[model samples]
Target: MRGIPLQKTLWHLGVLWRKSPLALSPEARTGLWKMSAPASTFDIFLSHTWHTPGKWKILSLFFQSGWRFSFLGWFVGASLMLLASTHKLLPLFIPYRSNFDGATISCGAASRCLLGSLLGHGLGLLLSPYAPSACARRPLCFLDVASIHQTDRELMERGIYSIGGFLHVSKELQVLWSAPYLSRLWCIFELAAYRTANPSGRVVLSPLFVECGACICILGAYFAAFLFVFALPLQHFGIYVVYVVGLLPIYVLMHLLRRNILAKHQLFEGLRFFTLAEARCESDFDHDFIHTAIRAWYGSAEAFTAYVQGSLRQELLASKPTTIPLRYLVLLVGVPFGLSLDFLAALIAREAPMEWLLTEFLAGCLGFNLCWFFGSVQIALFLCDRFAAPWRGGLFDYLQTLVLFLIFFGVYFLGSLMASTSNLWHALAVASASLLFAIVTLVCRRAAVGS
Candidate 1:
């Protein structure tokens, strides 16, 4: 009885279980969570030194074993999108390059919106398990209630991340922006409503605000760069005149600003060392979600820093397995480079005088960005962190990754089903179809971990 899992012993076996170190204390179990990670995600941290050494050995083994899945997932997703576009029956989502939906403007709003969310949510899911925080561990309580006191930002900076805290708000902004301009006014009310229901006092938001602002500013610059692409259809002299006057100068201004903020990813990792090294009792100061969220924003730079500083940390991780250098080499080459190629091709094509056939391609990319802005996979974020324990154990966990693949495939599936049936004026389903992926992403949290 002492060793049995709580659920199995209490409900299924109809017996009382005894105390075990691995069992989750009622404190961690308390709260509104429906789907939960295996208690082990937390339990390992609490283990005493005598048993920690073996656990550390097992972790390195696990990291080595799981590298394939990350690589394979990336390839499969890219290939699926490729086949979906090439096969005629499937709907191809092309981006539009029009500076204005109706009339010319100075920037590519849709692309900016897409990139904002892409960076925010994209990195969250991609790096979750291997990173210090799991995507699922969203909520943190203030003062521990037992300890009985703390301030708002103080509480926030502790690690009680709401599933939506890190990336959801910005993605939601995408939804707000995707709306018709008039509809955009309603977003303030939407924020007020969300805060009212979600409880701003209990939740944290520092990094979220900072990250969202950084994303807006950074992508805002990238959007400005596309202006050079937008005026391409004009006479060469006219385009050059516009590029010099309206585009190139502005883009340079923006890029320099973003380059400054992004350049220092390595410097921020030191905060983690200081915090971990300094932590003591359940003192309320160190565990703020707002602080942690802000800290999480640096991705590769942070990883690079951590790799460089190995063995010197104030608090060394029990399982500090080194990642294979090739994995990161793949990323440094793959992500931003691949995205840049797509961006350059679009930028060049948009600048080139229009070929009618190519018009649809640009049109599709713009449309996808609009769809992407409002769409989120926070639930996927939840599952990635939520069921992480059950994940390594067996069938149910594997099914979860399948959930993302299903939605990934379904976007093309539903779009193909609807788009092939009619003409653009009548049968165009890509907007709603892309949204279907977003909705599936929303629902899958419940399917696996519930939103």
Candidate 2:
């Protein structure tokens, strides 16, 4: 019996010694443990909040309708194009209202309402002749939290990388810039992602559709006043013409300067006005990639500039050369004022002679269109520079701005005179200048990359 007990104790002590912490070094012990699982990968990533339950409903509706989903910008551009061509007053003024209650799940969340409303409008517009069909095929809608499997940590980690990828490849970005959207940390990241993807401008502002249309319509009212309300002579009406047509370019130019200031100061990237208020209110998420990106952006002006240049250089070398979107080119560049040509003619035609009418119309159209294009080129160049290097400095940026200003101003100054000549020669002058400016812009962008 004593021998048996001693043998059992010795065996127990041996087992304890084998399992003791002193048996192996810390590194060796860690080496014996299993590692964490590698993150899962996916082709697409959607980024959004878990609180937005309505998004799932919207996603269901999208699939059930047998219609394809695309980015919001393509649809908005097509919608605007169609609305403009139809010469309809309804689409411009009428707000697109959705059947579903956007706020049903999320109280006071305006983005939910906007998402539903815009999708509804886009679905209706897709049936139209002018809708962008290319966007509909193999439609991929990335709705943040819905797209990622939250229960799986690996999937979520991989989803983060996919966010940047989807943003870069998406045909359009429809942003619902509500208070919640601006306040959320993820929303700002979405914006930065889209801006980097389409630096030449496919980033559509969902709210701007009606607002810009209304602004144009209001401008039309002023034109109508000159036509019917209080008749003014052609010469006097030209004052209003200059004021109206000129305001757009000036606004755009001033906007460029303001945005450049923001980007330079590292306050925000791309379109700052849309998210400024919300960004200020955004909750601190220390571990977020978005914050890391922001920190990298703020590290040092020179360091950030070099990093941007490196990124842009890599992008430029790898892909096709960057070209401005035709939609943005037409919309923001030269089309809005061109469309106003007929209305302008109508306003002054009633009060002026045929010669004066033709001259003013032609000249106004040419001048404004040229101005719009000039302003657009300036905008594009500035964006290119900003994208290439946010904190870019030295003589190049200044020289580029000064050169652009002088060239456009000279063209405008000459175009205004040629317009008043009543020979329609101003169109030719504007055409030549615009072509030259465009060529210069393309060349300059290339040069930026080369340097």
Candidate 3:
């Protein structure tokens, strides 16, 4: 096989992000290529569709690049929120009972508390910064838009033909997937070539919609936390009042949750049914080239198709039902956990006895925050496997919505009941049971995935 020519350059991922492919000056490109270490090999083969919006691509890349840091940032922010609230450094804006007597915080104060938490989160992210120097040390990627010649036809053809060589040398393939990605002939070629070239190499399937869904889920969690803070003071006014007040936000959250799950289902279905024949190419010459390459690599087009439809399908579905990373889950769970710190601060400000504080701690930390929030998310995702079918958009959809809402409501009610009880033994029992439930659910899911 003809290898990638020395003139074909690998781009620094940071440089590519900074001076985007569309606007790279010749001198800058030459400088970046010179800056790249081990010019013959690539760290990543970026498989993406040119048709995807640049903004979406950038966002996807952002998440891909700094996901670890993002998780750490969230953790730090949550910790800081708790620390500040415990020390009474930040004002207690969320209401809490004073010796089981009801007292409400002003709405303005609550809004400020929310705003402070957001700012703290943003600050935390900034603190866990990705320095330019650090980014420069990241993988050297073969991004076609930058790596391949765009304006020069001869060089472009050579680069296109040399993609197989690129894949052979690259360590991993990172697919910046969108709805149109699978349907693109070039995208399919890249995927097939990379897998064929390096069977043991990592192929990260990052659906663009996953990040969008994660953001929506995070926002929904924050909204739920906000409502929980509001409902805390109202618990003294009968649990029914709290439930009635929460219905609207609960409905909103359910809608968002269902929408996210459905989007994931659509993506999964697309992957399951993907076929090379259905993929489109802009040029007949390119199509022929890809076909010839696949035939050469895999013996025949039919064999390559089988590999994608069989092995690739199984690999993708292995993490099915929910492909969300654990880090994102931590971030999701952190929102409620962090917000619950306000309740702690409120108790401290009220000078509650140590026993009462200890009960609140166990109830909030173990019972409500960890057990309720984490377990509930897992249950929703697990249930999505069964419920995420074709949307009939009638009574069925409403029924699905109701089912989801009730599941969430039931989980919330259990956690609330645990928190409301003043008995330490009750809190401990609820916490232990909740923890056991979470552990069992996780173990079963892993077993199912393994099977």
The lDDT leader among the candidates is: 3
What digit string (tens of lDDT, one per residue) describes model 2 on residues 1-451?
Answer: 0001111111222221133223546553343222211223222223333223333323222322222222343345434543443343322221111111121111110112122223433454234222344533333445443343344567656755667666665555555322244455566566656656556534433321222222232233234322321222235677577656654554345334433333222322332333222343223552355657745544643443444345532432242222222233332332234333433323332344444445445445544444534444554345534543423566565554545545545654554454443344554455455556656755675555455
Cα error, candidate 2, residue 195 (Å): 21
State the weakest 10-residue window (summed lDDT) of model 1: 40-49
Candidate 3 lDDT by residue in tens digits, 1-451: 1222211221233334444555766666554434333357777787877666665555455554555556656666556666666666766654444333243323212323344455554444333324454433456667665576656668778878888888988887877777788889988898888887887887877777666556666777777677666665555567567657667666766666566656666666777776778989889999998888888888987787788878886775564434556666776776766665666656665667677667767777667777776777777656654575636776778677777778866876776666665666776777787787778767776765566
Backbone clash total for model 2 is 3
Of the two candidates 1 and 2, the one with more favorable TM-score, higher being better, is 2
Kindly report which residue stretches of model 3 are placed more than 4 angstroms away from their true locations once superposed. 1-38, 54-59, 98-117, 120-129, 132-137, 230-253, 263-268, 319-322, 448-451
What are the per-model C-alpha RMSD values against the true structure? 22.7, 20.9, 5.4
Between 1 and 3, whose lDDT is larger?
3
User: Model 1: runs farther than 4 Å from truth?
Assistant: 1-229, 241-451
Q: How far does residue 376 in candidate 1 sit from its true spot (Å)?
A: 30
Please tell me which model should have the higher TM-score, number 2 or number 3: 3
Candidate 1 C-alpha error for residue 278, in Å? 19
Ordered from best to worst lDDT, the candidate numbers read 3, 2, 1
State every prediction's TM-score relative to the real structure: 0.24, 0.37, 0.80
Residue 60 displacement (Å), model 3: 3.9
Local accuracy of candidate 1 as per-residue lDDT tens digits, 1-451: 0011112211212211122223445543332122222221111011111112222222222222233443444454434433333333232133434332244312121222223223433333334334332323322211111111122344333423332332222212111111121122122222222333333222111111122223333343344435633554577588778755674443333333323323122222432342322322233442353234324542433542353255322222221111112332232222322233243244343443343223333224322432332232233223333332333435554454455435533453343343222123322355466566556654553444211
Model 3 C-alpha RMSD vs. true structure (Å) is: 5.4
Off by over 4 Å in 2: 1-135, 141-143, 149-257, 260-327, 334-340, 343-372, 375-414, 424-430, 449-451
